[model samples]
Target: MIGSLFSRRRPPPMTLPDPAIVVPGITATYLRDDYPLPPEVIWRVLPFQKHFGSACLHPDDLRYEAREPALIRPGPLYEVAYKELIDELRYDLSPSPEAEVPVYPFAYDWRKPLDMIEADLDAFIDEVIERTVLTRHYYKDGYDCRRTVTLIGHSMGGLIIAGFLQATGGLRTRRRRTCPDHRVSKVISLASPFRGSFEAVVKMTTGTADLGLGASSSREREAARLTPALYHLLPSFDEGLEVPAPLPRTLFDPQVWQPSILRSIETFVARTSPITRTVRKRTEALFAGLLDQARTHRERLDAFRLDQAGLGPRDWLAVVGCGADTRTRLTIAALEDGPSFVLTSDDRRNTWPNGTDTGDGTVPFLGAEPSFLDRANLVCVTPDDYGYWELEDKALTRFGGGFHGILPNMNMLHRLIVRFVTGAPDPHQKTWGRPAPGVRPDAWDPPIPGLRNKAL
Candidate 1:
């Protein structure tokens, strides 16, 4: 009797229905599969980063440094899969001929140098212009084509967005008779080190961290002696570069270990005074410059907000993944306290690590989003409760992992996209998590099927 009274029961899981494959309201004018697909009907034309460390050494032309991630290894099957899903979802968007398609133009290997990556930005932008121009005729006219576009980047893709946005005002391409509608609606970054990923900074700062950092170890040194010019530009040293092609589904690809590797690298760097000091010295100026650029972009957006120019309620969204049992005190506190109040850890002096003040282990609250948008536009969700499981229609319902790579998995995030694109709610009313304050449609309790009172 005593045990029964004290017992705690776990909540029953919520059941979801099959995904609804709705036919798109619009029709395509071009011969559906032929050249010049419309922008609205296109799924995603994603560009990936190559090895940064080897950019200078390779005999290949500099113009070709950036390669299609699909072209490399494992085939471009992922694009096919993504396209199928888009078809099923019935989104009218197509990859515009005018869409940007710039490659990293670095070495194929992971350890490419930072300077090499930095040097390629101008060329990359050129590629975006050229590709977008080449693809312009693909748009199937008269389908209420949206002027603005969305950018969904992962890993180095996130870095690309940062660099591209920085060059926005100054970077110009040859003007065309008619500029295709090239506006950016939203930037969706997955597992991105937005505020300069800690890994990037650690490697670039310390010459010893890994190939990504341009460090030479017994293993690397024993092999071909890479030139110092070649060493600094590539990112082959970092372990993250080890991820092989032929993408895997669900959660992180198992290659992306969190906090642990980062912690270990930090520990190693901390213990060796020589390495620490050297890295700090080397990276200070470069990091400062990068940070300054990011800040400038942030400032511009902030100013845009101050005057209520070019933005509206619920216009932007920032999504991040957190581990189970993670505490978001800093994030909650930041939200509650506003940006003016500085957040510090227990010692009062020790503040939450940079880039992740409000994030789980990787993302920070402020960096997760700029101050330009209303707080209500931002939403943080966890994988524990929402993993790629079905709640509504099976076709419609997908789950996401608890890891940081939550953005790629279509199953879990598809609903969000559907809602975002269609400007409608999931008919089932599944609850991914709480929305940031002051969002549209007013807040409603999202319910799950076969469950009462308890919502997802």
Candidate 2:
């Protein structure tokens, strides 16, 4: 009896299977389609190139057998403007999408107010439930939604998640359609514009036709216009600043270059120089703060009492960012008479114009990091350690070589997702043991800075 008592009581730890991979159902949300497009491809394709390109890149890799889309439009300009009239722009309302209208995504349902992002998220949750079914991982397993569902968003998607969690009830508890077991277990934000960006603020202030009409009625329009960095582009909106038709006889041709017009350009250049300087300095500071925020965000998350939300220390959470040359060329491809919108990378490091230190073109690191108001559960990961990319040749294993959507498109991203989201042991985690001694943050050796994160 004693000999048989202790026979192989438990299997080896190495042999146990990971659970995160087996779960199904994931939803990725997109926004803003107000601009007219060819009706032939309206629902078939998205106007935003980055959005369409990223979605297509993940064809081979994504783990879940099924994926659906949740499309949200920003609130109407007239509704959002009501706050500006009453001057009720609190911290919560201060960040409203209305202030930056041109850049705000389009909305489908405009009957209700879009003040709290949490409300928008409730709709997203409803959509997910409408599209998915709840089921146990195994017959013996307990009913837990751990790896059943995930939420992936980019740019404003990050804003919605923050609003959802911070608005009214927490994200875990704000369920429109509770399945008793199914709930959002994971969130991934890629190159999202979280903090206010200088480029955006600058583009907003300038009254060039280049600014999309969406921002024309934004609450922040006036403030952004007064900003120094954006003031230079305002001359485009001038009407009859220089009238040479001898004391207003009906109307004068304002197109002619008069003395007043020359003075306008001169004054604009002089006034904008200082504002440009400030933008540069502030943008750099903002990036540094974002880096520090990522390091400390987890600490602040511990204070929230979310025990009922089904989230725990064991549950996984992460954030990813893409880095590239900030000074990408920008242009407005084709438009009727309105301003041409910018076309560039979404990351701040890459969006900063030439001579600037860093950006993803559109979003900066500090802005990309979760804001101070957020609950702080985000786990920041560089492209490499997170297993976002893998090259066919070991020689080409570089950070930037595995670019934005490269991780998901190359099957590398897909594998990493299934492994992490499903609770499976990651095969690549072992490679990133820790930093070696004397590995300088700005070291210039054989490998490049972009590829450095992965080698670690």
Candidate 3:
């Protein structure tokens, strides 16, 4: 007690980073059948992740909400995809012992439609805001608790984020600010297929895709046809179809889909159903629903304008990957059996203006463009971008170019995300791969005079 007599030079106030929510990609979230007595883990059972094979997301199952326990529910996120990113944020973002920075990994059923997922996200945002408000540091520091959350979405999760914004009147609305409108401080999307991807078509038609991760089988292919989220990821941008002229670019039309898709559905129905009506009728209806719903979803996003949506350079950060051979174009022709697709070969070099490469290997340059983000605005990163300190990440990576699945684990991006959310500049002032357009909104604590470029 006697040692406390001498006054120490005042210790600085503890700085806490803004709260963030991470929305994972399609296959990133594990699914479980809770209706079962002990709850059977389906999508991820150690070596047995059959995707939708074990748990088909048919419309029939969705209609069975009256069942006792519940239907298939989302479980923990796959460690391979997000464990490193989440752990880094949790530890690094927490500045002091008193700091209780919230970094939530939101898990949702990927099988549901995009709009339904958006509604679920709307509620999740409210929960996050409330959780942040209850934190002791928030009240002690006098930070705005309500509208101070940052959203980081990866892969298909990015599509969900954009959909949530549009649905909640956040991005596009000038009138009444809804849940996400005020709650979300900024949005950062990593390798999101805003214009959709050709890979989705490959999965639906052939039940297999070269997504840089995950394995595929016939069961998985049948599951892909049943899975609704894959359909939503179908390519929407113009010129995605390089060859097969006279074939309309619309993937939503059942006529354009490979005949094998119909056969697959028929096979699934014959095995699963009780043969009530003919298998053809049931198969056709299911196919129509998946395509039609995806069409409406894509149309809504294509029409959205980010400039008019009250979001600026700082509010929305678009992170895309490059320097990899990707399939920016496809050759879907009417063959002997029926219409089928021939994907771009790995050796072929695409003509994306960004670099010698096409995309992140999964999302092409055209696929990454959302009609709102210009060429200069996209924050492009490459496989060679992993910092010197991140030797482990580099060594572990077998295929350096097609970094579609592991973008979040990039240490360079972690620093950028921290700076953007905390409003605190990194010690070293530097720009990553491509410089995104516009200055950051929150630059300094007291607003530096010539700090025009600190916030990007």
Best by TM-score: 3
Order of quality (TM-score): 3, 1, 2
RMSD of each candidate? 19.1, 19.4, 7.6
TM-score for candidate 2, residues paired by index = 0.39
Overall local distance difference test of candidate 2: 0.30
Q: Model 1, stretches more than 4 Å misplaced? A: 1-139, 143-148, 155-159, 169-182, 191-314, 323-360, 388-402, 430-433, 436-456
Query: Stretches of candidate 3 above 4 Å error?
Result: 1-17, 45-48, 59-70, 143-145, 171-181, 212-214, 243-245, 307-309, 344-357, 388-402, 435-456
Candidate 3 lDDT, tens digit per residue, 28-135? 778888877898887762344553544675434432221234567889987666778888777767887578678899999887788888888888876776667556
lDDT of 2 by residue, 353-406 (tens): 222233343333444544332223333233343433343433222212223322
lDDT values, one for every candidate? 0.31, 0.30, 0.68
TM-score of each: 0.43, 0.39, 0.82
Could you tell which candidate, 1 or 3, scores higher by lDDT? 3
lDDT (C-alpha) at residue 64 in model 2: 10
TM-score of 1: 0.43
Q: What alpha-carbon RMSD in Å does predicted model 2 have with respect to the real structure? A: 19.4
Candidate 1 residue lDDT tens string, 195-292: 33222222322323211313334322211112222222222112222222332211112122232333333333344324445543333333233334
The order of the candidates by lDDT, greatest first, is: 3, 1, 2
Worst 10 residues of 2 by lDDT: 20-29
